[model samples]
Structure formats: C-alpha cells, structure tokens
Target chain A: DTAVSQTPKYLVTQMGNDKSIKCEQNLGHDTMYWYKQDSKKFLKIMFSYNNKELIINETVPNRFSPKSPDKAHLNLHINSLELGDSAVYFCASSLKTDTQYFGPGTRLTVL
Target chain B: AQSVTQPDIHITVSEGASLELRCNYSYGATPYLFWYVQSPGQGLQLLLKYFSGDTLVQGIKGFEAEFKRSQSSFNLRKPSVHWSDAAEYFCAVVMTTDSWGKLQFGAGTQVVVTP
Candidate 1:
C-alpha cells in the first residue's frame, strides 16, 4: 500500500528481552521519524532519519538504536527493554519536510 | 525549548453544538502549528496546519483554526460537531528550521460527542 507500514501491530515481551520493530514508507519521502506515545497519550519524538542518515536523536537511551538501511525503511532495536519502554511507537515519513504521514503504530508491552 | 499545551484534558459536547479545543504554544521564533485527530485505535490524521499565511486557516471536516500571534495560541473550532467527531485531538508544533522538524505534541484532549 502507499503508506507507512510497521511490523507486529502488538508486541509482548519480557522486561529484559530484546526486540525490534521494522518500519517502511512507500511515500518516496527522504525523511522518517520515530515517536513514542506514553499511556497518557503524550507523544514525543525519539529519533529521525533523513536519506538513511541520523538527523535527530532526542537523548533516548543508548539501549535504543535506530537503523535505516534505505530511505524507505527505518528499523528500531531496543536492548534490555525496561517496564518504562512499554508504549506505542509510531513511524512517520515526510517529503521535503512537508506533512508527516504516520503508520498504525506498534504497541510494545514489557511484562 | 519549544512546547505545546492543551489545557483541556477532556471535553464533552452535545451533537450539533459548536466545539472548540484550546491549544497554546511556546517557541523562540515563529513556529509551524498543526492540529491532528486520532480516531479509536487509529493513527493520527492531520486536521490542519499553519505555516505562514492568513491568521484564519480552514481545514478538513468543517474545522477552522485562528492563529493569535499576540496570545501565542492556535485554537480549533467547528460550528457544529458530528457523532463521529468523538476522538482524541492533539496540538503540535515544529521549529521552522529544525532538522527533520520533529513535532512536539501536547498531552492531547479527549473529545466526546453525545447525541
């Protein structure tokens, strides 16, 4: 489809386990972003990649790393996930710094 | 630092009634403003955006927002609301020259519409 897509709509894992979420955008955009939405519905930016290069990193823990193999895809890997890591992660993409289109989001739960 | 504030955490409005959601922003310079609506279990959809133009901007679904530079506010309003309008509304802002222009969102307001 012509939209931002994310793998595993819902995720449940142990607190110490490692997990990865993949995101892809077919909008032919040059920039992609990752945002975290807490239980209170407060959305915050975590990272952003432009043309497969890191552009913005919001002081997220080193345990959280983002990899963009190509401009169309950006994947997030979390190491030693903690209870606080549980939240809905959304992937978005924009063209020429225009409107950002968001994916359905991946809900991560650390049990 | 740039920030967005949505004072009303929740609002209940009767169908066919006028609706307004408050949003305030704090930025060092002229910032880009946006209003997004998220339906139940769905990603956010842009209702409107204000970059640079007239102070009053018209958006989709009979929505309109007025940018008050003096007050540093961009408030969303609708003459009449529908039942399907019950959802969460978020106010966001981005720096004009920010790299990637990461959007900073407010805490969001849960809007409920009743018949």
Candidate 2:
C-alpha cells in the first residue's frame, strides 16, 4: 500500500493556466510538506502544515497556495502558471520532528 | 543559518567497487542527520538517520554513514556497489531547535554504476 500519494503523476498545461495537485498520506502523520525539485534536481521546501495548520511558508510567489483540508491531506494550487513553474512537486508527511515519507512526485510541465 | 553541502555533484562507480559520498553541514549544534535515495522517476526513500548516541550508523542496501562532529561531516559508504545502487543520493538535516520537521537538504550527488 502507498504511504503517501499524489494525483496527476504528470501534468502538462499552457502558461497562464491554473492547476492543482492533491496529496494524501495514510501514515497517520501530524505534519505534511510540499517541496519543489527544479530541472537541475535542486529541491526546496515550499510549504508545511501541521495538523491542518500552516506552519512553514517559504518565499514562494503568491500565485502558489497550499490548502490543508485535514491532517491527512495537503493540496497545492497554482494560479497563472509560468514556464518557470515546470518542475517536480513532492508531497511528504511525518510526525513532528520525525522522519518524513515522500510521495512519488508529480511532474509539472508548462508550455 | 544552517546549510548542508554535498561536494560531489556526480559519482561513477563500477559494479562491485567501493563507493563513498561526502556530506557536510554548517550548524551551531549537531542536528538530526539523514540520508535519502531517489531512484529514476521515484520518490525519496530514507536510507538511514543519526539522531544521537552513535557516530556510525548502518542503513538498508548495505550502506553506512559515519558522523564526525569534528569534521562537521556525515559521509555515506558502501563496500560493494551493484548496478541497482545507482541513484541520486541526498543528505538532509533537521535542526533540533526547529519544532516542525523542516529538513535542510544538500545539493544531491548523482551516482552512476557501470558494469
């Protein structure tokens, strides 16, 4: 069984379009996070939620927003997507201060 | 500010050869250290972690890492490498002071195994 899972394993959309990625974890974790991996493979944290509460928000553009409906789910929405937004988005979950489990990742491609 | 560094951007090893991946961190106190492996088109898998008590820790797939406080390093090692061992290796750390499990990751090292 999958521990953490993300929808739309691959997405391709034109620039200026809007898209969203959904994440869910079955590990009974209290915290969840979103990380972006660029084409160069450098990964950076975007947002983190603890028990459905926003805890960490990096210096990402306002066009990017994270919504946590519950402790088990965290979704990312992007508005007016740009070509530079093309990258792999990863979802992770963990207990507070504990090891994290990552999803397979959603590859986003903006044309 | 705390940061992690992976000196080698890429490494190539022959099957059955020994392998070593270097990692260093900059932090006032010893932070929680971890090593993760990301295969092609795959998610990250935790190889091992060192919270405390021991400087050397063993991980799955016959991998091991040694934490050296003096050197500010935690280098991963494997005695024999197999073709399946090739993957992107990342060194990450969680600052003990951080309440949330925010991980500071290094620029990963890409390992390529050849026969």
Candidate 3:
C-alpha cells in the first residue's frame, strides 16, 4: 500500500485558470506539508498542517492556498495560475518526530 | 537562519565504486540533518536523518550519513554504488524552532553512475 498518494500525477492548465491538487496519507501521520520544486530542482516548503490546523505558511503568494480537511488529507488550490507556477508539487507527511514520507508528486504545467 | 549547502552540483562514479556526497550546513545550534534522494519524475525519498545520539546514521538502500558538529557537515557515503543509484540527491536541515517541522533544503547534487 502506498503511504502517501497524490491525485492527477500530471496537470496541464492555462494561465489564469484555477486548479487543485489532492493528497492523502495512510500512515496516520499528524503533520502534512506541501513543497514546490522549481525548474532548477530547488525544493521549498510552501505550507504545513498539523491535525487539520495550518501551522506554517511561507512567503507564498495569496493565490496559492492549502486546506486540510483532516489529519490524513491536505489539498492545494492555485488561483489564476501563472507561468511561473509550472513546477512539480510534492506532498509529504510525518509524525510529530520522524522523517517525512513523500508522495509520487504532481507535475504542474501552466501555459 | 538555517541553510544547507551542497557544493558539488554533479558527480559521476563508476559502477561498484565508492561514492560520497558532501553537505554543509550553517545554524546557530545543533540542527536536525537529513539526506534525500529523488529519481526522475518521482518525489523525494528520505535516505537518512540525524537527530541526536550517534552521529553516524544508517538508512535504507545502503545509504549512510555522518553528522559532524565541529564541521557543521552531514556527508553521505556508500561503499559501492550501483547504476540504479544514479539520481538527484538533496541535503536538508530542520531547525529546532517551533515552526511546525520546517525543513531547509540545499540546491541538490545529481549523481550519475556509469557501467
């Protein structure tokens, strides 16, 4: 069984469109995170949620928002997607103290 | 601010040869260090992590990392690398600050193992 899973492995959208990526973890972890990997392969933390509560919010634009319905699910929604948003988005989960487990990642292409 | 630095952007090694990837970090206090590997079109996988206790930490896929406080370094090493090991490796550090498990990652290093 996959510990972490993401829906729509690949997403292609036009500029100014709205899109959402869903992530689920079966490891029963309490903390979930969203990370963006740029074209240069630099990974940066975008947001983090613990027990359905938003805990960390980086300097991301207001267009991007993350929602956690429960401890097992965290979804990312992008509004008016721009060309710069073209990159791979990764979903990960971890317990209060341990290494994070990652999903298969969703490659987002904004044209 | 905690930061990770991977000086070598790319490294090539022959199959069955020993391999080493250097990672350096800058932080005010002892930080939690980690090494992760990412295959093409895949999410990053945790290789090893150093929290406390023994500096040497062993991980899956025959990978291991050593944490040196004086040098502020956490270097990953493998006795013999297989061709399948060719991938992009990332070094990361987590600060003790109560920011809800924030991790600072390095630029990453691409490893190419040839037969």
Candidate 4:
C-alpha cells in the first residue's frame, strides 16, 4: 500500500486557469504538508496542517490555497495560475514533528 | 530563520569509490537534521536523521552522517559507492515550531556514478 499519494502526476494548463491537486495519506499520520520545488530544485514548505488545523503558512501568494477536509487529505488549489507557477508540488505526512513520508509529486506547468 | 545549505550542486564518483556529500544548517534552536535521497521519478526517502544523542548517526544502505555542533554541519558519507546510488541528495532541517512536517530542504546535490 502506498503511504502517500497525489493525483495528476503531470499537469499542463493555460495561464489564468484554476486547478487543484489532491493528496492523500494512509500512514495514519496527524500532520500533512505541502511543498513546492522550483526549477532550481529548492524544496520549500508551502503549508502544513495538523489534524486538519492550519499551522504553517509560508510566504506564498494569496492565489494559492490549501484545503484539508480531514486529517487524511490535503488539497492545494491555485486560482488564476500564472506562468511562474510552474513547479513540482509534493505532499507529505508525518506523525507530528518527525520524519515525513513524501508522495511522488505533482508537476504543474502553466503556459 | 532556519535554513539548510548544500554547496555541492553536482558530484560524480566511480563505483567502489568513497562518497561524501556536504550539508550545512543554520538554525537558532536545537535542530533536527535529516538526509534524504530521491531517485529519478520517485519520492524522497529518508536516509538518516540527527535528533540527539551520539553525533554519528547510521542510516540505511550503508550511509552514515556525523553532526558537528561546532560547525553546524551534518555531512553524509559512505565507504563505497554503487551505481544504483546515483540520485539527488537533499539536506533538510525540521522546524521547531508547532507546525508539523515542515522541512526546509537545501538545493539538492545531484550525484552521478560511473562504472
């Protein structure tokens, strides 16, 4: 069984289009997180949710939003995506503040 | 501001040769350090971590790291290299705040292995 999984491994959309990436974890972890890896391969934390409660919100733009309906799922929705929003987004889950298990990652490209 | 730094952008080595990947961290508080490896088209896997106790930490695949508090460095080293070990190595530090699983990763270092 996959510990963490993300949908739409590859995403290609036009600029200004709205899209959402879904993430789920089966590791029974209470904390889930979202990270964005840019073209330079610098993986930075975007947001984190503990037990479906927002905890960490980085200096990301307002167009990016994270939704967690439950502890097992954390989704990222981007409104009015721009060309600069192209990057690889990875989802991860962990047992509190510990070593995290990461998903395969979702590659998004805005043209 | 907590951050992780991997100075080596790329490193190549021959099979059976020794390998060392440098990792430096800057954190105000006691830092939880980690080393992760990512194969092509795969998710990141934890190789090892340094929370406390001994400075030298052993990880899977014959990998080990030594955390030097004086230098603020956690460097990953292996006695020998294998072709399968060619991957991107990331150095990360866990945040001390209430937020969970927020890892500040360095710009990864790409390793290539030759026969």
**A66 in model 4: Cα distance from truth in Å?**
0.7
Itemize residue pairs with steric clashes in candidate 3.
none
Each candidate's DockQ: 0.77, 0.85, 0.74, 0.77
Q: For candidate 3, give the lDDT.
A: 0.93
Model 3: per-residue Cα lDDT over B1-115, one tens digit each? 5678999999999999999999999989877889999998888899989989999999989999999999999999999999999999999988876557788899999999999
Q: Compare the candidates by TM-score and give the number of the best one.
A: 2
Candidate 2: where is the Cα deviation over 4 Å? none
Best by DockQ: 2
True contacts kept of each: 0.73, 0.73, 0.73, 0.92
On a 0 to 100 scale, what is the lDDT of residue B62 in model 3? 97
| Model 2 lDDT tens row, A1-111 | 899999999999999999999999999999999999999999899999999999999999999999999999999999999999999999999999899999999999999
- Error in Å for residue A64 of model 1: 0.8
What tens-digit string does per-residue lDDT give for candidate 2 at B68-94? 999999999999999999999999999
- Counted clashes in each candidate structure: 0, 0, 0, 0
Q: Model 1, B36-71: lDDT tens per residue?
A: 999988888899999998999999999999999999
All models: lDDT?
0.93, 0.97, 0.93, 0.93
